[model samples]
Target: MASKSAKKVNLLDHNSIKHILDESVTEVVKNQGYVEDVRLSNAKLLIGTSIIVVALIAQFYKKKFPENRDFLLACIALYVLFNGLLQLISYTKEKNAILFTYPPAGSFTSTGLVVSSKLPRFSDLYTLTIASADPKSISANEPVHFTKSITGWFTNDGVLVEGLFWKDVEGLIVQYTKEPKKSK
Candidate 1:
């Protein structure tokens, strides 16, 4: 797959973009270059451990808080533990893929979109970067910090990406990251 100079990208179609976001991460990971990020595995485990410590402290010392607080602490500990376990699974796959990949998948409907280009810094192609924005939210629209400069991080708006449609994102990826001829 070679990166095309004239491929076209569609940024206005929020519905189609949402459809992709709604699709299972598991299905998307079936393609090349899609890795399950476990960057916070250690952090999540540490959080769960801390919660357990708090729970233990609550049990050991009575009346520092209410009796119900003890139960609440225990419940929070359990929830964090469950999430930590799932993170551990992702961490193992980050080591190497085995049977399959799964996500503690979540869904949140957003109301807007933000599209930008990652030109001059990380990519040589006029690669596209998109983000979902919530029209109703009052929070900042700070861009996500992404590491590992890859295919989608380019723009001269250099590559028009003509002819190809946006639904074929995977194909677009193939076009952009095709292996060099020397390898063949």
Candidate 2:
């Protein structure tokens, strides 16, 4: 009877120890996977930013030098095309949505307005409309009157969302009108 009792105690202790070890291993694996994902995401963002910078520089060169304008313009076009394609690839791989916040009142003109935002919720669709008193002369860096409207749930409080409509310009062009929440 004493031997049998001892055997049962040893078996239970062994099972308990095995369970703890398994749990610890699982936790470690999960944490490592999360870290790897974060690193990959950061790398992608950096690559995208670099491409955009290069494209901007090429555009500036195209505009500033008229004698070599053709060459610079070609470079600018290629850069924009390549960077856009790369951005699309990254977006598809990450399954990330785009977010854009409207600009505050009194800070944008029809020519100067650009909108962009962080990744939005997968289910949300954002539609932006640009209206101006004079529509024909709309271009970046030019001053013109405009109006914008947006519809979405505000997720983060106090975080200014940045966005770009044109490839090069960045700023707030419209403001959101917050609706009151209904009491349940």
Whose TM-score is greatest here? 2
The per-model lDDT (C-alpha) reads: 0.39, 0.34
> Over the stretch 38-87, how does candidate 1's per-residue lDDT look in tens digits?
44456557766776776676566646556567576776767677677767
For 1-184, candidate 2 gives per-residue lDDT tens digits of 0111111112223343333222332232232221112444566677677777776777666446768777776767777776777777567533321221222336443321122222223322333322222336432232322222111111133111121222111121222122234599
- Judging by lDDT against the true structure, name the best candidate: 1
List the candidate 2 regions with Cα displacement exceeding 4 Å.
1-34, 59-63, 96-184
Q: Pairing residues by index, what is the TM-score of model 1?
A: 0.27
Model 1 spans with C-alpha error above 4 angstroms: 1-22, 62-167, 175-184
Model 2, poorest ten-residue lDDT window? 1-10
